[model samples]
Target: MGENIDVVVIGGGYAGVMAANRLTRRDDVAVTVVNPRSVFVPRLRLHQLVGETHDAVVDYETVLAEGVRLVLDSATGIDAATRRVKLAEGGDIGYDYLVYATGSGSPSPRVPGAAEFGYPVATLEAARRLRSVLCDTPVSAPVTVVGAGPTGIETASELAERGRAVTLVCGGALGPYLHPRARRTARKYLARLGVSVIEGSDTTVTSVKRDAVELGDGRTVASQVTIWAAGFSVSGLAERSGLRADAAGRLLTDETLTSVDDERIVAAGDAAAPSDLPFRMGAYIAGCLGAHAADTVLSRIAGDEPAPVDLSFPAMCVSFGRRTAIFQLARKNDVAVPFYFTGAAGRKLKEFSCESSVEHLVNEARKPGSHHWPKAGKHRPVVLAAQRGESAAPAARDT
Candidate 1:
């Protein structure tokens, strides 16, 4: 190529786009982002398929920073020894600094036939397909959601509220990390909405077979649409690139978010597993780490010491529906401090929070490198004191 680019960001998700926009804002740096898609998928709001807010998203064309190049291709691997990224179609591009933010893919459901038949909302395409199937397919059709976390709960609730027969096959109680009361309350809400909650089922999804999912228990559910929302896995690109990855295949980084083997390489979002201070795969931490990664690269370029970044995060916000949510407050160290907000007012607060996060993305992307980050999340006095465990500790954030 002409010359090695300043920064090459992989995965055009929230973190990659934010970092590219920020890096290109400096005017002195040239940034290139590589991804397989044309648009930046708003993955967090994807569960509300039956609602208008379900389609919320920001196009990358409208927000990409100046002097930043967009390469439409999937990264097959990286030649870290030569500081080059191998693309599926756009060929090899060299870079001085690299940021991998490909995010995570939906973990394959383990129940028999789940892999072959389960529909997942992990990606924009998957969500779109699920939306189409639900809208066009038979109503009252049995739809089984095989997850109970934020995505699964929201999906099942949205489907059930819309008059669809939804069976939320929660592997655990709904909101397992939430306080006992919160979990009970969520279950009550779900039960009131005609959602069938199945808990403590040792589900082994063998594969997906058209319209039905077969569990290892030899039980079969006639689900016209089966969604797999259980866990996540990083793209194998990191492992293929010969980076220092962990057993789960996440790129291993230091407290400062630098690759353990190469300081010039940085990782954010689900693609990153920062040692001594790991973060969850939420967008909240991606924004923080994206900004931090940019700062680390900028400081190094300027021959200054890379400042240490504390994994300081406040809390997590989860939406149950359009008018209800749970703002789970945590400690400064990110343990749930038994805080909970619910009902209509809680829903409004959730709306405010989601809108504010969207606005921050737009503002920061529009300005490209304004060095803006979210202030810590505030909590209400109703902190659910009943929950003070390490599961709240998290497998742990835009993180």
Candidate 2:
């Protein structure tokens, strides 16, 4: 055999781990995963971590495939011209190919005093800190959760279920991604848990103080603890390395997930913006993109053209505490439909999804190239065509 191809995957999140494991399909490829933490973190379960229900970490030994080298360090930058990744702890690792999968983190809050007083629960470290703060505060203390996204809702409901006075502030509609029907159901469940739901155009948080939060409507809510789940943002590693990235810091790539500036480099998971359009950030999408990225690398190795990504979102599930949940079904294009499942069935589905996500990684580690996802037709091309003011090709239509 020829010299082994060294493939370095930055970030050991779902995408990086899956990409690293799938690369094992080629015996000639040597995979090395560079991550800050030794343990794998299930980002979806971060709220549970804050509520003291789960730790939100897994052993890499159980998820990473055998023979894959795990480097317990963070990637400071990528020197694409030299095919090396700079490490935070010093030194660099040379690679024949590189996968960019640095996942995401809480955006630097812009609201006045939010940076000083608000607590974000997007990443593992943030969740741990929030958990610590909650432990010290009395259960009777008023807690205000900002943002109506899944993270905000989950955190608010989890705390409310624990008998804490919780207030969920939605900048606009509750669960913007959920269908109206699903949104109503979610509101009902949250109310049943004794959560005060605040929604409307004027519900935006103007500022966060140590003991209160001011809303746009000029109302100051008493919040002994403020949890910020506004949204997530990717690291600046790509832009820091002089690579092109979208406004949100996601590394820009072609539809095949290959870096536009450097074909030798690919991106996956939440850190990747393909065709300037990224999939919804989640473990499920990350795993699929990871596998597709590995296939692109393997194709390059075999001197074949890599195929474009073909996957679809079927449903989105969010839990209300540990008992009730909502599963909003969507079309292949990811637009939510009126149909949804709630209550016991929804709870079971949400749990299954969380467990199956981890199981998918373990399965891929045991069997490389075994991961697969349903195709959503050529919807992206059609959408892009429409954006360009050009007629869509017949083949781009959904079948």
Global lDDT for candidate 1?
0.73
Model 1 TM-score relative to the real fold:
0.87
lDDT by residue for model 1 (73-129), tens: 988988988998887885788898999888887776555666677777888778888
> What value of lDDT does candidate 2 attain over all alpha carbons?
0.92
Model 2 earns a TM-score of: 0.97
Model number with the top lDDT: 2
How does residue 104 of candidate 2 score in lDDT? Answer: 89
Q: Which regions in candidate 2 have their CA more than 4 angstroms from the true location?
A: 391-399
Task: Quote each prediction's TM-score.
Answer: 0.87, 0.97
In order, how many clashes per candidate? 31, 0
Query: Model 2: clashing residue pairs?
Result: none
